[model samples]
Target: MNFDTKHIVILTPGFAASEEDSTTIPAMQVYLKTLIKATPKLNITIISFQFPFTTQTYNWNGITVIPLNGKNSKIKKLFIWHKANRVLKKLNLENPISVLHSFWIGECSFLGDKFAENNKLKHIVTAMGQDVCKKNRYVFHLRKSKSKIITLSQNHHDILLVNHHLESEIIPWFIDKNDFPNLKENKIDILGVGSLSKIKNYPLFIQIIREVVKEKPELKVEIIGEGKAYFKIKRMIKTHNLQNTITLTGKLSRIKVLEKMSESKILVHTSTYESFGFIFAEALYAGMHIISFDVGARKSIEEWYICSTLEMFKITCLNIINKIENKKTRIVLNCPENTINLYSNLYDSNF
Candidate 1:
């Protein structure tokens, strides 16, 4: 009922369960939290379409969180649309909703597009990572709403342009400098950070680790993430007898991940594809040497070596390991706020 504050609706797959919830979507938790701090006048309603969400309506730093399946049910997915439409109707009656934005090009985009069309509001959808590369049927809607789509990097832009023939804008991710720690320590030889998904190519990371240990017997390799391939990657480590050299920490808090990064020497990112590799940015900020597969954040991160192939990655690692292994350096990265502010202004403008 407050006309003074503009209401913007955001549809996401899942959000942090609460302000203190760090296990899910940590980057987005930090992102929206920072965005709210910078822009206090906007009222954000985050509709998390979590199939098995435990909580219903809650407050996250003043933002309203409405989870779809707040209670566990067998047929929750069956009635998701009905639940979403009911919420949308209630929201429209309460306030003049300005914008409907979705983070992915799938179901959320469908909901946002429909809501925007029916309510006569602005709709924007973001194509992230494999969403643009994979065969997503809903992405066809972006061709009609070409200007309203925002991607993460030029690589993604090119992919969208070539794959789907959809021209869009770019908005890179930004890190708040206040969050990083000022620690200088080297406890690990090589580090791989990301989920154990097929897209991350963790098996290839294991192969590289196996190769690296042959040269450096005393090397320490640690992977800090968890996914469906936990057992598969564990099997690889066991089969290769890398029990001493390689260790998987299995999903730590964001602060702990950054702390672990600060204590590591090198970060090896072997992802098949990424729109904006936020982990690389965090690693470079922690001053760790990075050997990535020329994906997102490859051009912006300092002291990061890009490799076209896994062989090149191994060669680059062999060349740089000893020089920086003993010392942990904190690289001063320049994450501009212009783009971030532009996004904030766009959201405020309700477009």
Candidate 2:
């Protein structure tokens, strides 16, 4: 163990199975890689509670990862937590962990908060996605603990403050410019990327696209992702005879998805809620116009329009497709280093 290096433990529900497993959680994968590059002296250890369905420890991009394989079984949750506490104790003995950072405000945060309090160490919990808005009894425990809370965007911060009355720092996620390939020729006119979940509201996406194609019948659109809503969304496309207008490519690798964004002209995000839309940042970096509901960071970047209603969403898509609105390729948030620095400060803070 290197005494001079700082050891930071990360707790999450799941993580990439391997370096090649880019589809698991693309934003988290990018963030962790950037963190390592930004601070080479920092040591990162991940303890995933339930994912990859394996108990074996492995290395991901030089970072040590230990998966508990909880399998999301409520009957086994207590046993998993006890096992995780033992692992934390062992790691603290080895390197004296500087901080415990947990993703999401659920089980991981709950466990991290308890462990950090008992050990008198620093803990930080990031409210990711629906955790800020959804009902979670764990939030009450976290609010009482010494753990510092962080949110991804202003929208998320506000939601947390209003819903849970918890104050938090806002650190937006960024895209690494080096990961993108050279700009390719635009082959797709409209694009959508995300899980095919009901919360993503793909039905509204289909409705807007159905309207857009009435004027521009030859529009080329693609939705890249896979989930329970696949068959339902596919059936809707066929029912509306949009088989020629829209194509569901299912799920693609993160690199492939970025390539698709590069080859696309516009991105339509129909999600009902978003803590912070990482895809929006990716689309902006890929030089694509984005039309989405006023969710996530909702930064006022050029070529990105926020719509209030389905009619507005339809109009915005058509306007961009017909060139009624000017388009520009802009990178709104490009400083992953700043995000890393913010977390580094948090890890070193006395509070």
Candidate 3:
């Protein structure tokens, strides 16, 4: 099974339909572009297990994408996997795949396992957030198998080892500093990013905002992103009588989000769980103060105002508001180059 060592196949849940599409995973789009930039001679083929699953080949940023229609019901998706397998076999015959990289551990890993076994290709899965959680049943078998696994943070790495006896490569997600806009003058007092779903815990974020707003009457809070908890968050804001002080901007483009980050003073992330808080890194880079719970990003950055208790978070918020009025510089650092280098090194490896 000698093949072009530089060629690789990437499988993911969703990817941006194009550069302008903001709905896809931001990290995945960046990863694909960076892969091409890091390995100039590499050939990339992306297979998506998501919508518009037409069995056709299309080019996105010079990478070929093959989607087998899996956006249907459970039974249809099950059949789509076998259909995808046939499409993949044709791809291998045309251009031998060097490696199979699954972005998440469930269906992608299952497909990766079958594809690699048939093609005799090396395989790896990046165990992201909930994919390696207790409920994803595939973790135990995926870990026991020979397939290599990688995690974005040590928290998830430890979870894999403790729960499944799996040791995974720790590869942090890298954000190219050059991609971000320069920080502008802070216009808003607080900001929240990420979905408005239950796990994101937007209600808690609103509570923290409420706490800080009480201390600084002029300060205001803004949230970006939308989900099932939209009306729930709205109801909470109304119940708290924060109609004028708090604002929900709905979902915005990544560029627009960065622009908004530049205009904000603090980022309050109240999520109960995070594989890696990309917004924490982005907000920090934008020179905004970050107050977040003990999660994945807690271990990576040192300057963030990490809070363990709600009481502590409220105190931290008030203290930050005081600093804002007094005028103090925020702490921030550039993205980790080593993280990108590690992934690039993996791409360059023969295995």
Candidate 4:
């Protein structure tokens, strides 16, 4: 693949819908905006299946947004591949589309395969985390057919190799340093970010907080974001009498969450798997210590803290607070530009 391509299309399932202020969504927008800024000649378009009202033409940072509409049913979603396949064909007929990039390999990227086959478009699918981590039998064929899958961590690459029986290149998620404050002294108690779901392992978080408070009795933990586990998590918080220590902020704007991250002393991530740990990297960049269970891209993080299990996680948290008292944590800012540039080079070459 050449390292310089001017036109491309990205197919995504949907942007995170947190009243338009989700951290995940802004993180994506920031990265895409940076790509646009770096390569002004590049024309990028995002086609989302979730948005029904997207127009034939709309603009953000010189990039185009196109949404395809179809029947209102699960069948409609299944047939989106046909709709997108036709649209890309028309696009090729008029202006010769370049690369077709799929953000994840399952449904959204399935259309990319059809588009590539029909129009000879260069196709690439970047698997985030869940698509590969959580196993399901229904998409077995989809897993087998996909080629050129991109992953963010070596573990993710290994997961695909072991389970899906395929090889994938690593393309770590990027974070714009300009958007993050430099690592400062720990001011707040503890921080947790991500959807409040089982895979995220929120119960483990509650358990760790309770253990830490038993010793110090003053330690506090804050959880950000909302998910199906809201009520259950609230019940646990109340039952443990952690109302004074643990706070579920529900869903908040990206900036507000960042504000909380900036003030926090430690970040506790308890996911079973991660394609790449975005918030973990962000916390490290902000100069806060992080202690995460051995899941996802936990090993990918450089220069910080880690734990093997929920029990080890509690011990690690205590040590982190003690280190804060001793003032001995060293944090560094690692740039994702090299990784992003590598992917861009690959895209250009494929195009």
Candidate 5:
């Protein structure tokens, strides 16, 4: 290893388990990739420790990925702490590992804190939606950690402070400008991205589509991605007789999703909770108007129109649709290079 090049270890869920970015794996990859692209002065190596299910060697840009799994047993659950610390220790021996970062601060948080404390390494853990929202207060409180925990929005940070009794810095996620395309000459009606999960509330999105179609027959709502709530959302679409007005595009590549964003007039983020609304940031970077339910970590978006209830989301959607009809063009947003550079500096400082 180059003496000046820093080795950075990121503990996340299995990337091989899922397709990409939907979970922690790809999101971390995206951020690292952006950092490398925006700042070449830094030389960094990233090692990602995934769940036991992962058995593959993957590379992101120039970063080397090492996948490891944990044993499946009652003892294994209790022993995961030791197992994770062992893995981090083993990796540190090969290179000058300086910093340890993790996306979720619960299961992985303890592991990161343990590794950093044992080895005297700098550590940073981020609390995504599930960590601070879905996880019970008692559980989070019990797993208290001293590592700097990062949150994507002030709302989630407040939630963390209240629930976990911990203060978290708000570091919002960013979408690259290249991820978006020039606004399509002919705009489509609506686009939504996310798994067909219960928290996404796709059924409610369908109902809003039905209400929109009543006024504008040309209006359409297209949902991208499949999940546990897939068939349920489809059923709602069929029940509302929105076969023509609503469409589910299933899972799509990041570029393909961006293409859909380019064609759409607006993007709706209906998730009940999110750490940082990735799709919402992508939509904003794609220059599409967004009317989202006021839940989750959507700090990248302006808080001019926030709706806390389904009824409010419906009203806001209708209003945004009307504005879309009259506006000559949508806003184009460019993510700051400094934001990307921050990750690069942190990665390089790991040395």
Candidate 6:
């Protein structure tokens, strides 16, 4: 079937409620905004399956967004899919969608793959976060379908290949350097970002801090973001008597988190896994050293130190802190334009 090359539709489970809602998938927000700015002539529309909790269509940064308000109820998912199909039909009738891009390889991809197969449209599914590692039934369907698949990092691509024997393209998300603030003096000695969830492993972060403070009691540490594990983490902080040494600044805006990164010396990411840790790029751009596990897109840069064991984390933290004055702040990975160009080529290509 012939399709209009000027229009594209994006499918996702959730999206930022408003332009000001920075906490909800900030990386995706940066990517979409950059994509819009880079391609002025392209028409983009977003179909959010389970966010904003409203059935209202609105505009965000000049792009049209249609929220289905699925609210993530398992029993109501089929009804939501039916409504989404109706919306897509109306949208296609008005302006034929050239391509369908879904954020995760789950429900959104399932719907997009089916619709695209029926309508002869190109579909692309980007595997985000745990969806690649988890036991998702949609992976099997997508493997047998015609939709193109993309993974954020090499780690994610390997996992998808091993788990489902699926091949995918790698398109890492990048940070926009222009959004950062001026650097400030290093007031906080250490920093940790990401949700306070079990996957993030804030408990290991607290344990690392507890060990570090034994040698240098004047250590100042701060953790940003909030999640279901807040209370348990708080109790651990209190029990370790780290109230003075550590501060929990729960859920800061994207700008505020960048500001904190500017004033910090080092970033310690203890997460068990990451598809592509956006924080790693953000911290590196802020000129902060990163100490993380061998997860995500592991780079060979000197400042990004990857650790394997708890002992390695402790040693790396101490070694970096002892000579923190000698470290320099430099831009490592700020390639929003490159990412945009890659996606633009994919959108214009024939599947």
> Which candidate achieves the best lDDT against the true structure?
6
Q: Could you tell me the TM-score of candidate 3? A: 0.92
lDDT of 4 by residue, 1-351 (tens): 322445687887664332343454564676787777776777677776665444355565666766665433576775776777766777676656788888776677777776676666677888876677547342364454534678878778888777777678877766676765544555567898988888888988898899889997888788998999999999999999999998888998766877788778888888877777778667766667778766555654544566777678888788767762544343443355776587678777743
Residue 189's lDDT in candidate 1: 74
Write model 6 residue lDDT over 143-175, tens digit each, in one string. Answer: 789899999999999999999899999999998
What Cα-based lDDT does every candidate model obtain? 0.78, 0.88, 0.76, 0.71, 0.66, 0.89
Residue 112 C-alpha lDDT in model 5: 73
Would you list the clashing residue pairs of candidate 6? none
lDDT of 2 by residue, 273-298 (tens): 99999998889989888898889978
301 Cα displacement, candidate 6 (Å): 0.6
TM-score of model 1 relative to the true fold? 0.92
State every prediction's TM-score relative to the real structure.
Answer: 0.92, 0.96, 0.92, 0.88, 0.84, 0.97
Clashing pairs in 5: 52-69
Residue-wise C-alpha lDDT for candidate 5, range 307-349, written one tens digit per residue: 6776787777777777635433434333557556555555445
Q: Model 2: which residue pairs collide?
A: none
RMSD of each: 2.7, 1.9, 2.6, 3.1, 3.9, 1.8
Q: Candidate 6 at residue 175, lDDT? A: 82
Q: For candidate 5, what is the lDDT?
A: 0.66
Which window of 10 residues has the lowest lDDT sum in candidate 2? Answer: 324-333
* Better TM-score candidate (4, 6): 6
lDDT of 3 by residue, 278-335 (tens): 7777787777788888777564453488887777888987787676343434343325
At residue 250, candidate 2 shows an lDDT of 87
- Runs of candidate 3 with Cα error greater than 4 angstroms are 1-5, 52-56, 299-302, 324-337, 348-351
User: Candidate 6, 227: how far from true, in Å?
Assistant: 1.1
